[model samples]
Target: MNNQRRTVLKSGSGAALLGMLAAAGIITPGMALADWNKAAFDAKSMADTLKALGAGSPADSKDVQVTGPDIAENGAVVPVGVASSLPNISMVAILIEKNPNALAATFVLPEGTEANVQTRVKMGQTSNIYALVKSDGKFFMATKEIKVTLGGCGG
Candidate 1:
C-alpha cells in the first residue's frame, strides 16, 4: 500500500510540474494572454462602445437571446445572461442603456467555445439591456428591459 501511494504521488507531482512549466512560458509561448479592448469598456455611450468594439452598427437578430429578471429588487447586482444559437460566435457584450457607462461587460470567446455567458451588473435605474453578439466579423443584437426598484449605483 505504501508503494502504491508513492507511485500515485509521483504521478500527480509530475502533472503539476508540467502545468507549472506551461504557465511559466517554458512549454508554450503567447498562450497565456487574452485580447482585451480597454477603450470599449471605458465608453459611456452605445455608439462609442460599438466603435471601440469595431461592431459598426449591429443589426437586430432573433438568433441571439438575452435573459434576466423583468424586475430587480436591488440595482447593485442584477443578474444577466447572453446566449447565441448563431454559428461561429466570437464575442458577447452586455450593455445597459441608462447606466453612466453604457458598456457593462465584454466577453471574448476562444475558438470552439460555446457562445454563452452569465454575470451580475449594476443598474442605476430601469433601462434596456442589450446583448451584442459578433459572428464572422459582423455584429447582431438582442434587447431586454429590466426594472430596478432600489438604485444600485449609489441611490
Candidate 2:
C-alpha cells in the first residue's frame, strides 16, 4: 500500500513539473498563437476597425487592386480578391460596410511574400468592401462597392 501511494505521488509531481515547464515557455504550447481579438472586431465600425488594427491615417492606394463582382447573385459566398503592388507589405485586412461587424478577415503577409489574398464572406446587404494594406509600417487602403441582388441573411 505504501509503494502504491509513492508511485501516485511521483506521477502527480511529474505532471506538475510538465505543466510548469509549459507555462514558463520552456515547452511549446498546445495551440498556435491566435492574437486576434473577436469582441473588438464584432461591433466596430469601418473607421474604428481601421484604427483598432493599427492602420492609422491610411491613404488611398491605386496599386491595391480589389477584384469582386460588381453585383453578387447570392450574398452567402461573395468572392473577393485583394492584391497589392506595394513593397514591404505586411498585412491585408478586409472590411464590409453593411455587415454587423465591419471587419471580416485579416491576413498576415510575411516579408518577401506575395501580397495577395482571396476569401469569401457573407454580406447581409449591398455594401462597400475595403482593402487595407500595411506597407513599410504605413497603411494604405482601397474600397470597392458590391451590390447584392438577393439578401443572404434574409430578404
Candidate 3:
C-alpha cells in the first residue's frame, strides 16, 4: 500500500511538471505524440500498404529474417519475430498476405537501437508472412509461409 502511494505521488508530481511545461509553451501536445501511420495500418492490400508507408516494390533480402512456426495449430495467437542485420534500419513491418488487412504491425526504430521485435498476430488462414524493412532510405523484404490450421480474424 505504501509503495503504491509513493508511485502515485511520484508520477503525479511528474505529470504536474509536464502540464506546467505545456502551459508555458516549452512543449506542445503534438510533440508528445508519436506519428501514427493510419493509412498503412488501414490498407487492405500489400501494394497499398507499401505505398502508404512510402515504400514501393521492395527488393528481396536475406538480411531481413522472420521466425515463426511453419504450422500454427491455433491461428488466434501465432508467435512471430523479425530482425534485420542490415545497417541503418529505420523501420520494420510485418505483413500477412492473406489477412483482410495485409499490414499487421509496424515499428519505427530510433538511431542506434537494435532492429528486432517479437509479436503475436491473428491469422485467418495459412498465409505468406513477410518482414519488410526500410534501411538507408530503401526497402527490402523477406518472406515465409505459415500454415494455420484454425481460423482467427473471424475466418
- For candidate 2, the 10 contiguous residues with the lowest summed lDDT are 26-35
Q: Can you write out model 3's per-residue Cα lDDT over 1-155, one digit (the tens) per residue?
A: 24433443488686677667658755545443224566688799889998998999999999999999999999999999999899999999999999988999998999988989999999999999999999999999999999999988782
Looking at model 2, residue 140 earns an lDDT score of 91
Clashes of each: 0, 0, 0
Which tens-of-lDDT digit does each residue in 53-135 have in candidate 1?
89999999999999999999999999999999998899899999989889998888989899989999999999999999999
User: Which stretch of 10 consecutive residues in model 3 shows the poorest summed lDDT?
Assistant: 1-10
Query: lDDT at 14 for candidate 3?
Result: 67
**Candidate scoring better on lDDT of 1 and 3:** 3
- Name the lDDT value of residue 152 in candidate 3: 87
- Candidate 2, overall lDDT? 0.82
TM-score of each: 0.75, 0.75, 0.76
lDDT of 2 by residue, 48-124 (tens): 78777877679999999998999999999999999999999998989898888898898988777799899998888
Better of 1 and 3 by TM-score: 3
Q: Which order, best to worst by TM-score?
A: 3, 1, 2
- Superposing all C-alpha atoms, what RMSD in Å does each candidate have to the true structure? 9.2, 8.0, 7.3
Which residue pairs clash within candidate 1?
none
The alpha-carbon deviation from the true structure for residue 134 of candidate 2, after best TM-score superposition, in angstroms, is: 0.2
- Model 3 per-residue lDDT at 146: 98
Candidate 2 or 1, higher lDDT = 1
